[model samples]
Target: MPNNSNENSPPKVSRQILRFLVIGGSSVAIDGICYALITTWSGISPDVAKGISYVCGMLFGFWGNKVWTFESTKRSVSEPIFYVLIYACTLGLNVGINRAVLLLAGDEFRLLGFFLATGTTTVANFVGMKFLAFREQLPADSTTSAPSSEPPEVAIPVSDRRAA
Candidate 1:
């Protein structure tokens, strides 16, 4: 059996990355669908619709990443909060990159800007989710409670003991 401690093995990391990409694609689809529906069918402002759709996508991403992609068993109340903060930061990064690219390259390269923003934010979100939001936390007593490196003492009864 594979050792559990060696979680950073190439195969394991590859699997995690693949799962992350799948979840990311699903999240993006959810975001796009929601955005389109809200913008086309409702009176909501486009900006507000975007925000709502982003949140929906963020929620799905968090759930999928936590449960399937990362497979983290450690739980903490701060996980969701950290996830939201990370997504918010990535959202700003995405918008900034897209706008900056458009400004530099002109509106003719709008698709390039979109692709750049999407790619950059995707990478950022993966890093943030892996390292911050769902990282496994060592137990509080792990250090102090570690087993001794010395061999365990073996008992010898008088009948079993022989003179050296």
Candidate 2:
């Protein structure tokens, strides 16, 4: 049988986690910059700016997570569509968490609300992406078959051996 030892090896979990964190950091930076710029220069309302920035940031996050974090080079047509669906679902969760935090903390502590909201969203996104979105990268099976040790053997009758 052909050697297949490497097939059973587990994925590089640490590396994947690190890449995810790095991509998430970059996405956060993009979101913050876009939010700040539009709010400051474009005369956009804070809510509108936040909405635009969130979309932009999500795009960045999707691309970064797909290409860099997961190392997925699949250019299949379904990939982007799947990503968009996930992003839209997560966006709703993000907004809901943000609003909930804001309401609980009251308007006086808006900064705290924002931080709490972002933190919760980040955790949720990471868990979802790592476990569900990129599960295909990891091996699906655990058991492997190795070659048997017993060798083929034959026995001849004593009478036949003597005659020969």
Candidate 3:
């Protein structure tokens, strides 16, 4: 049978990816604006301004991804921990890949290295955020009932069973 409803709608994963990108873009814009404002209007140093803006962006990204991109309802203490870990790993990956490409390809290919690193880290971030950081955890007891002392029941063919 044809699934008409499914045919009309994009897959759930696609929607999630789109939402994730939107959230990421927004976060970047927020980071840039905050950085500019801090650096321009305040006496804070550029490095400190960058750090503050980065934190602001990260906080917004976390909330947006958790509430909108993943549509997660139940909150776990480990979710933020996982998010931070994933981001940290990706950040390292991005820098390492960029540096490697620059070393191998020369400074002339700086833009190329930058793009490669960005692309790799973007994909890694998405996958990690989707599968690991935002994954729902089931309770240990939810998968099983309390153990019973009785033997398990076995089915018998109706024709072979004795009449009550």
Which regions of candidate 2 deviate over 4 angstroms?
1-11, 87-124, 137-164
lDDT per residue for candidate 1 within 68-88, as digits (tens), equals: 999987778878988999988
Q: In every candidate, how many clashes are there?
A: 0, 0, 0
Error of 2 at 72 (Å): 0.7
lDDT of 3 by residue, 73-151 (tens): 7678888998999999999999999999999999999999999999998889888888888875554444356667988
TM-score of each: 0.73, 0.56, 0.79
- Model 2, C-alpha of 7: deviation from truth (Å): 7.8
Pairs that collide, model 1:
none
68-142: candidate 2 lDDT, tens digit per residue: 877676667666676666666777877777787778877787777677767776677666676556544434342
Highest lDDT scorer: 1
Q: Of the candidates numbered 2 and 3, which has the greater lDDT value?
A: 3
Residue clash pairs of candidate 3: none
Candidate 2: C-alpha lDDT: 0.73
Better of 1 and 3 by TM-score: 3
lDDT-best of 1 and 3 = 1
lDDT by candidate, in order shown: 0.89, 0.73, 0.87
Candidate with better TM-score, 1 vs 2: 1
Off by over 4 Å in 3: 1-10, 137-164
